[model samples]
Target: MSEALLDIRNLELRYGAAVAVRDISLQVHPGQLVAVIGNNGAGKSSMVRGATGLVRPSGGQVIFRGEDTTRLPANKKVARGLVMVPEGRLLFPGQTVEDNLILGAYVHGGIKTPRSKATLQRVLELFPRLRERLHQQAGSMSGGEQQMLAIARGLMAEPELLVIDELSLGLAPKIVDQLIGVLADLNRTGLTILLVEQLASYALAIAHTAYVVANGRISHHGPSAELARDPEVMEAFLGRKKTAA
Candidate 1:
């Protein structure tokens, strides 16, 4: 079996006296799609922040590519192929779509490099709407388009392990379905992904392995299909008792 691309061990994050996350350990192996599903404020976002170095964890370790990166800065992590598309789809509002993509390639040698140019082409292909609006201000696009741009920007970084937080947030069902398809296709192409999502059904459908986070720790984990059928998981998402086998 191939080694894990990202391994987070017993991670802990705090805000003053409050604990956002505690003792969370998860793994995403090469070419695997792993999902972490939970309700809002379930520490899902906090876990991603700690793992990506956007916020430092108080304890445990973050190992990427067989090395300790617990103390590395976010920019350094990006340079090493660990990139994240954060929850808010934070883009440069005033900048054009093309400019935002160029910024994403900064760690890999900017858009001028041959590799960066190729990545940009591939990203545009993945989201043809982005190609059409390349010269438009990023902020002017619809929420779904903005989200697609955020993901495309992450791809411009040439990440080996892509971490996405809250992928389906605030989008119409049709748009959400389209984005889910895109993620599945990306995974089929061998990209390792660790997705933190509130929409459990969609994430579980595309994931191979999944973890259920609640309060501040993992409460259940296993194959996505099994978890989808789990009674407790069903109740949490559907708010109704499960009657199916």
Candidate 2:
């Protein structure tokens, strides 16, 4: 495999005295869709926070594009081509959808350059719904549309690796399916992705590799297909698949 685009080695994270991530190491190589699946409070989000520089790690390292970025701020990571679409669709409620996209390009100085303008055009092409609602207030959109906007905004940054946290959160199964397809397509187009999703089945369906998190640690890591069929993992997380009686 090519050198990793994002590497988290022995990463530990804490909220004051409470440790959320414990010596967790993971990697996302170019053009691979890596999924991190776990139940709530399993430290999935915390690991993402630590890796993406939204929160500082209590221990270990975050290497991006072969550089040590452990203590860098979130904006700095964004500038380095490591972008994250946070768990919640944290859009500017009062701003137009266009404004939210402009903010995504803030690191590039807000779509002023020709390159940024081309990126904006590509994002709009990828999400036509966002294009139609460019003038609409971000908060006024439906849940799925808002999620689409969130992803579109992220693309405006032109990240080399896109880390999406809890993509299925607060979304209907149908919406999640649609977004999953979009992600799969993105991966096929050579965009590396680290998808942290609670819905194991959905993520595993699209991911090339998967890590199962339990109790703030990785309980399993393997190819998605093999892990999907692993009886223990299914029983532990997917709750025993039903068979036709």
Candidate 3:
């Protein structure tokens, strides 16, 4: 089997005295797409934040490429090729699309490497809509376009492990399908992806593995197909019997 790209063991996070994530443990192998599915406030976001070093875990460890990175700063993590496209499509609202994408390569520190340009071209190709809006202000784009821009920006980082939070937020189903298809293509090309999603069916369709989080802890972890068939996971995440297709 390919070596694990990322591992979280006994991870915990707290906001003041209230625990946000507790004892979460999971692994993502190279080129695997892993989805973490749960309802809002189920600690899914906290887990991603902890993994990306945005929130220091109160306990446990985050190991990346066999090295302990529990206490590493967020910027250091980005430099090491762990990138996150945060929820709510965080982008430079006033900046041009090209400017936002360039910022994603800031970890390389203005080196102007050929790799950066190649990566930019690749992203624009993957998201052709972004090509026409290269000079447009990011704030002027629709919600779906802004989300695409946010993800394309993260791709410019050339991450080995990409963590995406909520790819289907506030968009039409067709737009969500298009974005997820792009993400699926990325995963198939050997990029390890950790996706936090509320849409269980859509997420499971592309993921290799799935985990269900509830009340700040991981309640299920298994193959995506098996997890989709699992009554417990369906109840936890979807809150109803999955109708027969």
TM-score of each: 0.96, 0.96, 0.96
Candidates in order have lDDT scores of 0.91, 0.90, 0.90
Off by over 4 Å in 2: 238-245
- In the range 1-245, model 2's lDDT, one tens digit per residue, is 88999998999999999999987989889889999998888999999999989899999999999999999999999999999999997999899999999999999988899999999998888888999999999999998999998898888899999999988889888999999999999999889999998888889899999999887788999999898888788777752335333
Model 1 per-residue lDDT tens digits across residues 46-151? 9998989999999999999999999999999999999999999989989999999999999988999899999999999999999999999999999999999999
What does candidate 1 score on TM? 0.96
lDDT of 3 by residue, 1-245 (tens): 87678999999999999999988999999889999999999999999999999999999999999899999999999999999999998899999999999999889863288888888898998989999999999999999999999998898888989999999989888998888998999998888999999988889989999999888898888999999888767766653335785
Of candidate 1, the 10-residue stretch with the lowest lDDT total is: 236-245
Q: Which parts of model 3 have CA positions greater than 4 angstroms off? A: 238-245
RMSD over all Cα atoms, model 1: 1.8
Write down the lDDT that model 3 would get.
0.90
lDDT pick, better of 1 and 2: 1
